[model samples]
Target: MNKIIFFAQTRELVGVDKLELAVDQMAISQLLEQLSLRGNKWSLALKEKTVLCAVNQTLVNYDYIIQEDDEIAFFPPVTGG
Candidate 1:
């Protein structure tokens, strides 16, 4: 199982804080595409907006391949005041 987590505005938009997916290995982009298919809110949050991603607590790009039991997190870019 792959654990997916959402934070900040991304979580508000997606309407979920976390979820578990039964995926073994897949690219981050592919995972995003799959989530976008869930509904309009998912598409708007994941496909339309730009969000930072991390796999196993290390920031990564869309090309990163997710492994089984990996913890994936999505959140908006951090801005300093």
Candidate 2:
């Protein structure tokens, strides 16, 4: 199974802190697209804004390939003075 985690505003917007998926391998974009299909709230939270991503604690781009047992995290861009 692959672990998916949400942080900060993305977590608040999605109403979910974390989840697990039985995916063997897929692109981060594909995973995001799948999550967006869950409902309107999911779509808005995942597709309407720029979300940063990390795979196995390492930052990665949407094109990054996710493997089984990988841990993926999504969070909104951080901004502060």
How does each model score on lDDT?
Answer: 0.88, 0.86
- Model 2 lDDT tens row, 1-81: 988999988899889999988765788888889999888878777873488889999889888888889999998887879
Candidate 1 per-residue lDDT over residues 23-75, each given as its tens digit? 55788898899999999988888863488898899999998888889999998
Candidate 1 structure lDDT: 0.88
TM, every model:
0.90, 0.89
The candidate that achieves the highest TM-score relative to the unseen native structure: 1
Position 66, candidate 2: lDDT: 89
Off by over 4 Å in 2: none
RMSD, one per candidate, in order: 1.6, 1.7
Q: Which residue pairs show backbone clashes in model 2?
A: none
